[model samples]
Target: MAIYSCFLGKNLKHLKIRLHDIKLATHNFSDKYKTESNGHTTWYTTELSHFNKEKPSLVVIKHFLPGEKDDEEELFLTELEMLTSVKHHNIVTLIGFCVEGFDMMLVIEKFSNGFLRDYLGNVKNMRTLTWEKRLKICIDVAQALNYLHSEMEDKKIIIHTTLHNSSLGLDENWGAKIEDFQWAIFLPPNNKDGAMSKITYSNHSYYMDPEYAKTGMLKRESDVYSFGVILFEILCGRHADDQIYLNGSEKGLIHVARRKFHTGKIEDMIDPTLKEEIGRKSYVPNRGATKDSFYTFLEVAHQCVAEVQDQRPTMKVVLKELQKALFLQVSQLYILS
Candidate 1:
């Protein structure tokens, strides 16, 4: 209890913003201030009233969802606790929060580029993430996961259960900022674990770790599997959501990768826009991404998405491989070209 008191006190002292201030900052919660919402949670952008003629800072406001009062409140506190405890550059920043009346909200840094799901949704937007940018996005999230899995000295193994495209945000510089920790869980170091179920059982299966799904023993490697799904999404430009599976057979990224990944037809899986980008380069291996770069990248993804959890690489290992890929692609990657 003393440990928890310390964390709660630390968080509140620095992060408690008055509800009146938030209302004023968000223009009385006007619709125009809203940037995005998915029915459950809504996001608004605004800055706190200036104390010093400083530039009007932009920030994001996440309205805690309203529902069955008891469950929602518990979930809200859990999420708040985790956000208050864990802070990282790659993960979205929490500026403050408000709990007034029926409204419970978390204040976080706003990312101008929105969710990574945005680009992957349409072929037209695929160009927004050139091959170079795509690799960097993966690297960004990989490092973020590395932090969640091992870098936090005291936060234990924080597992993000919903590590999908929509949760991966992009800031003004187009870097990755992982968010949506409402489903995250914290456990002792390297202890396989699962969060108490918050949603229906079926909805929880989408980003689940298969072994954990089967054995009910959640491991950090579960995140590795989900990251593998994201890696393929970057390479193939598609959603790994169960909707894809429900719509067709042998069409999901995992299905396609399993059947053809090592059979020399894996090249078919690369999104055409990315292929065109690579084709623009005269040298097969531009800077660092060789013609076989997709194979190598997907190879890592393959290991990550492996059906057996034990086969998955640690997030650290995943980040290292991604770094090597980024170095090889440096010549053709975003900054240089």
Candidate 2:
């Protein structure tokens, strides 16, 4: 057995220790990573190193249950290899990994601000994420997706099968970083004839593309559809699966958003947590500052989440649009400053 000590950047002392050492430090591996009632993986907060510690990091230790299938082990190794190969500013970094016995552990860089879901779901944080911040986050995620889809030569057309609010992390600077690549799929090589090129697993109902879910077809367009849902979530400050009050009845946010968008009542979809000056309350604002911003954001969200997947813009295009929106916002801020 070979023991490897890996260091991040130039610091050799801040290396990630082996999983055996980690298990000893924490004690009770099963208690460390308990399974949730829903059967999804649940990680303990104590497993992660303190952010203020020297060369702070996150340790994700997942234990495979007894009689785990071979497919599960393959999936874990594939994900680790994929993450280790790619390095981008907006993509989460894999510090190191250990596959000792039945335990699989991944050490990754820690993001201080938590996931995008926390900011969007919490009413207080929703107001804190201004239009400027939201636009920046959209641009960041779009750039990351674009890199995955086009720029990377080895893994071109990489599909993040799971794209949701929780998979997006926020750094201390509030910039967005795409995380959790365990479900990612890389397209087959050009010379591999008849080789399977895509993966289609059942995704979260809210984020799953109708076309892909029905036909088991995996395409770049599927990512576009999920991106649309994320854009709508950002604009409306509601989960895709959430129900909203609309037209004297409760309906899913998607339904309400589509109807309001078609009827030109786009402003109605804005989250109520935003200030009246930011255009959430009244149809007509005296200053018109919030009204214009809200409408502009709504228009982008509508384009992203269009019913027809073909009409949706690619991540590259989306990134450009978001950057333009951010520039405009910054210019306006400069005038105010």
Ten residues in sequence with the least summed lDDT for candidate 2: 1-10
RMSD to truth, every model: 3.9, 5.6
lDDT of 1 by residue, 1-337 (tens): 1222444545386677778888888878899899777666788888775332477568888886677545555556667877876878889887777776777788888788878778875888876677668888899999999999898976577978668787899999989989878767887765654444333224435556667666766668888988888898888787765465445453366766666676867667677766654534454323223444555576788899888988899999999888777666663454444
Q: Cα miss at 315, model 2 (Å)?
A: 0.9
- Which whole-number lDDT from 0 to 100 does residue 149 have in model 2? 72
- In model 1, what is the error at residue 18, expressed in angstroms? 1.2
Local accuracy by lDDT, each model: 0.74, 0.64
Model 2 residue runs over 4 Å out of place are 1-17, 30-40, 46-58, 62-68, 189-203, 245-251, 278-296
Over 199-293, each residue of candidate 2 has an lDDT whose tens digit, in order, gives: 43444667776666556666666777788788888877877766454333343566677877788776676766543456334333122234455
